[model samples]
Structure formats: C-alpha cells, structure tokens
Target: MIGATGFIGLNVVDALQARGVSVRATWRKKSITVFAQKRNPEWCLAELDDTVALEEAMRGCDVVFFAGGHYPRYSLDRRASIERGRADVRAVCTAAMHADVPRVVYTSSIGTLDGSVAGPVNADDRTVDPPRESVYRATKWAMEEEVDFALARGLDVVTVLPGACLGPWDVRLGTTGVLVALLNGALPWWVDGIVNVADVRDVAAVHVAAAEVAPRGARYAFGGVTTTMRALFEDLARRWGVRFPPEELDVAAAYIRADVEEAAAAPRRGRVPMPRELVDLVAWGRRVDSSRAALELGVVARDRETTLEDARQWLERMGHVPRRAEATAVRSRNSAESTRGASAHAGSRKR
Candidate 1:
C-alpha cells in the first residue's frame, strides 16, 4: 500500500491484517511514528513520487493499491499543487506497472462522479459531464485515466471510487478528519451539505475484494448511507453529550460564491477564504449506491448510525476534543461583547 499511515490507509492496513494478510505499508518521514512504533512495524518510509523507493516497495507484491492523494478542501496553491497531484498519480501507476504488480486498485473520489441528478447514484451512473467543482475532481479524473493507461498496457487494474468516507480511524484523514474539527469546535457552523458516507473498514474490504473479483478496467462505487448536515451534527452532539441546534443553515450558495471570489482574489499560499464550491458540496451531498461492490466484491456497507457512533468514540479516544474548549471560549467572548453593546445603547437612551 502506498499510503499506509493515513486515516483510510491505516484502517485498510488493520483490516487487511485482520484477514491474515501480511502488509508492507509505506509512508513519509513525518508519519513514521504512527506506524513504526506500532506493534506490527512492517511500515516502510517512502514518498509517493519517489519512483525508486516506490518500486522497491511494490517489488514482488501481488497487488498494488494507490490510496495516496492530497485533499483540495481549502484554497491551496492550485497551479502548483494540482499539477503535482496529477503527476503523482501518473508516476505511481506507471511505477506499479513497471514493477509487474499483477493487480492494481486505485482509490478515487465520488466528487469526480456526477451527482447533479436526484436520487441514488450507482457505480454505473455516468460521471459528471464537464466542469468539475474543484481541482480535486480534475486530478482524480486524470488519475483514473492513468489507471486506464496501465490497463491498456495489459495490467490487471480496477478503480474504486468512494464517496465521503467516514468511520472510526479518521485521526489523520483529510475529509473525514473534518469530523474531529467540528466536534472540537474548530468549525463554528456546519456547512450546508448532505454527505454520502462509507465506513472506512468497508472501503478497505472492497479494495481487497476487488483485487480478485472486480473485472479488469471496471470502476466500482464504494459508499454506504447518506445524511444531511444537520443529521450528522446532531448525531455527533448526541454521542458527545452536547447540545446541537437544529436550525436550518442554508449557506451553500454563499459559500460557493465566496470560494470562487476567494480563489480569484487571494494570492497563492495565502489564507483563502473557504470556497463556495465546498459549501455547495456539503449542501447538495448526493446519495451513492454500493450494490455493485456488495454483489461483485462481497463488500457490504455498515449502517450509517454505526459509522457515526464509531467515529465519535474513536475521536474522543484520540484527544481531539480539546479544541471544543477553545470554541467555548470564543463563544463566551462574542456573547460578552454583545452584552456590552446592549448596555451602551441603554445608557445613550437614558441621556
């Protein structure tokens, strides 16, 4: 596995290990602590774009899983980082093929898949026609094409596209990690988006199964249940014994427009305001179907409630709630400021 130290990658390593499969997972220098000191200690240090190290990692392996990618959730140095993401995909797939790995499974995003239509989105549903919401989609799409290039070269390859994966073990993930941020009050308000989530474990299971069952050049959708922003927050609040208001927060359009304007206005690597595209993504979260994974790969998605409960418990264990205290301080300050303003208005009226 290329990204064995990340949230999804670590979960995958554990799931694969539980199935009695020996894994040699790779990570960068910073993530070494998470895996090197662990009980198994089969973690190797390597960068994704490092062809020599990557080839060494894949040598003699029966299957290669490319699960490494950057999250484009914020305003990044789009011109540089986006190209780097696309290039990494190409390099990894090309290296895997050169290493003679018999089977390759590439992890992609449902963001590249179309969700404009109402109702459940199946693996067979046509991908979005054009104009993806952000560079993430564009890069994932390009990487999927790279997979196709490998398949054309007579490599056994399949792509697994998962949507907004969430479950336990999001300690280091990008998107699902957002749950920790929200619970810790790093996020003041939940964006307006419905999310189609798959359990991290289930996504890993499907990846392993696809090594054998999924047909060459096929793409499988690997998502489970769908929940609105309010539903997700309330679930977390209940789990944490906190109060969450059920007020409707419809800021999707504003966020989308703001993201565009921010992206347009901000300098590279500077603080870019949250993009509206993400807000819209949260608000219009689409439903995804995993029937193909269930029937073909023998993978079944866990219940949505179970996924959330597991995430809440796992996050608490990881010491992510300290930020919740920070959020409380901010709220108290705002309230005090409001009170002072009210008192000043009353004094002026008496005068």
Candidate 2:
C-alpha cells in the first residue's frame, strides 16, 4: 500500500489486512502517519518523486500497488501539474520494471475517462492524450499514458478508475470534504452537475479482485450509484438537519470561483474553500456503468444511504465534523458489505 496514509489507501489497507493479505505499506518521509500507527502492516519509507527509493521499496515484492500517484493538491499550474504527474508515474512504472515485479495494480480516477453527456460511460470511453478540460483531467490522463508505455514493455498492469469515493477514514477529507463542508456551513453555493459515487470499501475490494482475477490491462470503473449534485446536497441537508445553500451556481460561475479560491490557497498550501478538482469532477462527471466489476469480481455495493451514514459517523467521531450532528450520525458498522475469501492472496503486494 504505497499511500497507506491517504483516504482510499488507508481503507484499502484495512480491507486487505482483514483478508489476511500481507502488505508492505510505504509512506513518504514528509507525510503525517499518525493514523497508520494503529494499523500493523510492515512500513517502508519511500518517496514518489525519488525513483531510486521507490525501486528499493519495490525490491522482492510480487506486486506493487501504485496507489500514491502524483495527484496535485491544487490545479493552478497546468503545465507543471501535467509534467509532475507524468514524471511521477513514469518513475513508478520504471521502478516496477526494474524490480522485476510481476504485476502492478494502479489506482486512477474516472476523470481520465471520456465522460459521456448522452448516457452512462464505461471503460471503453478513453480520454484524449491531452484532455480538453481542467488540469486535474490532463494530469490523470498523462499519468495513465505512462502506464500504457509500461504495458508495451511487457509489464502486467491493471488500472482501476474509481469515481468519487466516500466512506470512513477520510483524514484529509479529500472527496468527503464536500460532505464536511456542507455540514459545517462552509459551502457558500452548490453546483448543479452529475455526481457518480461508490463506497470506498467496495472500491478497495475491486482492487484486491483485480490483482487476484482481473485480466492484465483490464480497467474497471467502480461507481455503482449516480445522482445529481442538487439532489445529493438536498438529501444530505434533509437527513443531517442542515440548511441547504439558497444559491445554485452555473458551471461557468463555479469554475471561476474555484479558480479564484485555488489561487488564494496555493500560497499557504492549505485547503481551498472550493477545490478545483471537485469542480472539474462534477462538471465533467458522467453516470458510469460498473457492471463489469460486479460480473467479474462479484462485488455489489451496499446501500448508498448506509455508505453515507458510515462516512458521516466516522467524521463525527474524529471531530472533523462538529459534535452537533452526532445524534443522527453514528450507526452500526455491521452493515452489508461485499466479501471475498483470502484463498487467492499469494505473494505480498507493496502499496
């Protein structure tokens, strides 16, 4: 688990450990890993920007989970973002090749896919080399291209395209920040657009399944539920007893606001009021068909309501969310979730 301290990476670590899979998790020297201290996986120190260190960490591992790809925090500098993302992924792929690793399960975003305005999109909807939209889209596209280069060099790699993932352990409040922002009354206006979502646990399960059974070069989009931004915001506000924003911004206005906020947040390296990626994701998001994962991996998502509740409750417990929501937030953890036997976990995989 390369990004053992991240939102999705931490969930993936827990899921794999629950199945008795040995993970050689890596963390960057500068990353705060207090959360990882509770988890008992073997820790390795490796930096994504350092190819030599990453290669050393990859030594003797059967598979590498390239989960810690170079995803920029803000989308202000397009050319720099694209170059950094490309270079980082190129290093990851090259490290895997140099270490003679057999397989690599890479984590990528659905932004790299060709989103459809007509209907649900799937794996076949490939993004153009230079994405026609925001820096986030272009960076993800460039990173995936490096994986294609590795595949041509005889690397066995399976890429996963996960939609807006939401569940527990969102320490940085990445995707779940939208939920937190809404609950805390930080969101000034809502943007009306498509939002495809999935449980982080389900997404983690598919990563394990892809390594175990998916064909080489296979890509799966893991969003099982689709809803519009307005409907989603309204539902959360109604359920959590919070007031929804009165104003709704058009896509154009949303982008302009996000850019302005991102520019301000760049200097402090702090969280933005409205993330540029969040804007790009919803503006470019498409309802996706994840039937391939269900048919091939036998992974069915739990109810969307249950998934959201788990995330809400966890945030409250961690105090990232205000204590006022606790009355309706906390819930039982023994809810319906997809399961897989540990019979297939072979040699260790380093994330």
Candidate 3:
C-alpha cells in the first residue's frame, strides 16, 4: 500500500488488516515516524519518483493499493504541483507493472469528474476540463490519462474516486479542516455551497472491495450524501454546541476576501485564510451518484447523522475538541439562552 501514512491510506491499511490481509505499507522520510511504530505492518521507505525502490517495495505483494498523491494546500507553484502529481502516479504504476503486481486499486479525487451537468455525476460522466490556472484539477485529469495509458499496456487497475471524506484518523485534517476551524471559531463564516460527504471508513472499504472484485480498468465514484454548506455547518454547530455565522457569504464576497487575505499574507510567507480554489468550489458545488459502488461493490454508506456523530467522537478522542461533558454543558447553555430570548420576545409583544 503506497502512501500508507496518508489520511485515507492509513484507514485503508486498517481496513485491510481487519480483513486479515498482510499489507506492505510504504512511507516517505517525513512520514516514517507515523508508521514506524511497533504495531504497523512491514514498511518501505521510498520517494514517489524512485521507481527502483518502489519496485522493491512491491515485490511479493499480490495486490497494490496506490493511494499516493500530493495536494498542496498553500503553494501556488503550478508547474511544480503538476509535475509532482503526475510523477507520483506514474512511478507507482511503472513499479507495479515491473514487479508484476496482479491487481491495483488507485485512489483518485472526485474533482476529476464534471459536476456542471444537471444530474448527479456518475463514473460514465465526462470529467471537467479544468482551466489552465487550476493546477490541482488539471493534474488529476493528467493522472487519469496516465491511468488510461497504463490500462492499455495491460495493467490491472481499478480507480476509486472519493468525495469529501470525513470520519476518524484525519491526522492531516485535509477534508475536515473546515469543521475544525469552524468549531474553534477561527472561521466564523462559510460560503454558499453544496458538498457530497463520505466516511473515510466507507472509502477504505470501497478500495479494498474494488481491489478484490472490481473489473479491470473500471472506475467507481463514491459519495454518501449531498448537502448545502449551511446545512452541514448548522449540523456541526448543533452537535458540537457551537455557534456558526447566520449569513452565508456570496461568491463575489468570498473571492474578494480570499484575494485580500492572500495578498496580505504573501509578504509574511503565510498562506491565505481561505484559498481561491475553495471559493470557486463553493460557487460550483458537487453532486455525484455513487450507486455503482453500492450495487457492484456492495458499499453501504453510513447516514450523515451517524457519520457526523462519529466525527465528533473521533475529534474528541484525538484531543481536537473538549470532553463530552464540557460539550454537553455548552449545549445546555445555548439551549437556555435560546429559551430566555424567546420568553423576552413574547413579553415585549404582550406589553
């Protein structure tokens, strides 16, 4: 399993282990600390561009899970980003092919799918042609093209594209970072948008299932629920006993704010509070149909409420949030305030 130290890859490792499968997990120098523990499976340290080392890592492993990819959160180096993204997948595929790995489950992002159409996007839907300026999307599209080439060369590969995955073991806090910031009151407002939510556990399950049973060269899109950003924030606020901004920011306002933040932080060598890509995503929301994964792979998605509750619990367990008792106290106080405000309004009307 490449990228075994990543947020999704770690969960995939856990899933495979639970099923009693021996996993050959790979990690880079920076991630070795996280995976070098006594309990981890066999480990291999190799850079994404080093095909020789990766080939050594793939030896004797029947199934390879290529969960490796880079998503820069702050850097604006377009050329560097695209090269790194393409190289990561190419290295994995080349090494897998050389090592004669029988099957591979590659993890791709939902960003590669086109969401501009009217209906929920499925695997069959065309992918968006990301503009020249959007390095991340363009890179992913390029990676898919690479996958197609590998398939033509007779590599057994099944691709899995995951939507916004949330749940336990988000050590990097990639997808769920917004929830953390909102709960911490650092980001008080959100842009108007819709997002498809999926549990990381479910995503890992899908990857394992796809590796075992999915047809060669097939792609499966995984999405749990489609909901507005406001609704998601409200749900988090209610469950975490916090307050979110009542008004949602429009696209123009969000873009302007992002620009200002980026410009100001550029001098300090710091990242913008909100990125332009995020604002654009909010303007163009995503809605995908993942029924193929359900019907073919037998992936049963957990309900939104259950997923959120599990996220809250995991956050607390990971020391990202206050204790359960403290959270309950906060909820009680907010409930009392609401009651008092209601009574005061009723008294004013009577008077």
TM-score of each: 0.80, 0.90, 0.87
C-alpha positional error of residue 247 in candidate 3 after TM-score superposition, expressed in Å: 5.4
Instruction: Estimate the TM-score for candidate 1.
Output: 0.80
RMSD of each: 5.0, 13.6, 4.5
Measured by TM-score, the strongest candidate is 2
User: Which tens-of-lDDT digit does each residue in 99-185 have in candidate 1?
Assistant: 888888888777666667667777666553433455556555666666667678788888888877777766554455556656644
Candidate 3 lDDT tens digits, 270-323: 544356556655565778889999999999788988778777687787777766
Superposed by TM-score, candidate 1 places the C-alpha of residue 126 at a distance from the truth, in angstroms, of 3.8
lDDT of 3: 0.78
Pick by lDDT: 1 or 2, better one: 2
lDDT of 2 by residue, 173-206 (tens): 7888888888777888768888888899998888
lDDT of 2: 0.83
Model 1 stretches astray by more than 4 angstroms: 36-41, 128-130, 245-280, 322-351
The segments of candidate 3 whose C-alpha lies over 4 angstroms from its true place after superposition are: 35-39, 131-133, 259-280, 328-351
Q: Model 1: how far is 49 from its true place, Å?
A: 2.0
